[model samples]
Target: MGGYCGYLATVGGLAAGADAAYIYEEPFDIRDLQSNVKHLTEKMKTSIQRGLVLRNENCSENYTTDFIYQLYSEEGKGVFDCRKNVLGHMQQGGAPSPFDRNFGTKIAAKAMQWISKKLKEFYREGHVFANSEDSACLLGMRRRALVFQPVIQLKDETDFVHRIPKEQWWLRLRPLMKILAKYKTSYDVSDSGQLEHIRVSSPW
Candidate 1:
């Protein structure tokens, strides 16, 4: 979920040429994380069994009891108790914020404009193309959308080929590797409590 949010935030920032980014993560402690992970892993394994039992019984009371039992056994009593006051209904009751409504309208307008422009460009290129039924292909709003043709074979032979030159690959990877090394060193120090053992290596 963090990764997905990060990706969306990055794309939105890049599209708007924003100066900075903000990030958020699910609130959790080390113990909470461990408990959640263990519970989820075990629950997944028995999910099919529970589903089958619920289907066979076909009673709301039995299904509810089984679900509570599963949650209590795996995630402990806190989660089980909390489930009693579930916020499922409250989540759907809020009014749409002004920002959300404005953003939605803006995105729709931009999508229509982009699709119209792409259609015009495609026709002007004198390339024989059939109208696509797929909204995604017809819309041409994908990441790096303008860099490729609709035909897969043609796309591969055109600008898509060698888009990343050797120098470009090295330029991207160098800083990423450096950051990874720094993180590794920091992690080692945190784990062993040995500040002197941490060493930095130059990439030259």
Candidate 2:
């Protein structure tokens, strides 16, 4: 869940009743694999101690669930039961919520309207509609409004290497989400002068 629209996916995980959601906001590096696994396992230890179900969303392109599951299991000393469910070829497939259904309908309606207008103008001009920002735009909801953005501009804003948008609006909600989930993150300096994160139980 830490790739592409990971923030939104993290929200969906929370909505699905996960006790805690771990979102990977940064890109995964092979050099940091060991440290990353240790870090995640340490975080999961806190959730396990509190008897909470945890869900981690990471970029599949960088690492697979197997890597995390296997490493986490080894770190857990066979005490924690780790399970993995693979939904092949399903893009978050499940029963659509009312809000999602409504949003889809609205988007479709608006898209058809826009296409119809373009078709009418094209016929009126008796010439092919040139590919421009107006002709090639993505209609999406941004901040509760249906905004259209040029594909060219979006391409420029994309992290081509990662194949995700460079700027994600939902990232701002990461801290708030963690706070609401009762995830208290505390930091401390070890004897080796290394920084370490220690999870503290939330009062609320």
Candidate 3:
């Protein structure tokens, strides 16, 4: 979730009243800035405490097309004893399994319900929101029900729009994706939809 999906997640998380969004900090590693490669001292840790660090002037993960972000690294946080996990290919390209199907159905149903409710409210209030800024309401989950969120607290714009907020819980898990990405066979081992047979030594 480091690209467009990441952006949407950040905006959605903010709209949903999150304290802060977890984005990759600048200078993920000091070695990225070196003209010639030196011995890499900053090693990847297993815990959130040691895995992330503070953003430095040399970090490149802080940039976004639409919004500026204040990113922090897992190393800088000094929270060691990190644990990492991934759901892998099934999440990206595999067929939808039972849990995925069920969860998707539930979320989709709630989204439709929110849109219906929005149109009904708009009709009754005689307010029409045609612009993206006004109509782009953030949808969120409140308890078991799907709720609406506004980024800028534009009460007037809420007259018409349905939007689902981002999943911050998942957003927080994004860093692990990068850490484990080194081991994923999909990155360099797989080419032309065929997986290579040789064993990979180090992705880095």
| Best candidate according to lDDT | 2
TM-score of each: 0.28, 0.64, 0.32
Write candidate 3's Cα lDDT for 20-128 as tens digits: 2333321223333221111112343422212221111221444331112121223323422323222223335567789779877887887788778667655645675
Per-residue lDDT tens digits for candidate 1, residues 1-204, read: 122123333333344432222222112233533433343344345522121110111122233434644644565433223223222235343678997697667667777776777667557466635466332342222353323234543343343332321122112222232233222222223332322343444332
TM-score, candidate number 3:
0.32
Best by TM-score: 2
Which candidate, 2 or 3, has the higher TM-score?
A: 2
Kindly report which residue stretches of model 3 are placed more than 4 angstroms away from their true locations once superposed: 4-23, 30-91, 124-135, 141-146, 151-204
Ranking by lDDT: 2, 3, 1
Question: lDDT for every model?
Answer: 0.35, 0.59, 0.38
Give me the runs in candidate 2 sitting further than 4 Å from their true place: 1-5, 16-24, 27-64, 88-91, 186-204
lDDT of 2 by residue, 103-183 (tens): 999999999998888777666456766555688889998888998787887987888876677776655544444455444
Candidate 2 residue 200 C-alpha distance from true site, Å: 7.5
- Clashing residue pairs in candidate 2 (N, C-alpha, C atoms within 3 angstroms): 1-57, 1-58
Error of 2 at 168 (Å): 1.1
Cα RMSDs, all models: 15.8, 6.9, 16.6
Window of ten residues with lowest summed lDDT in model 3 = 32-41
As a whole number from 0 to 100, the lDDT of residue 107 in candidate 1 is: 65
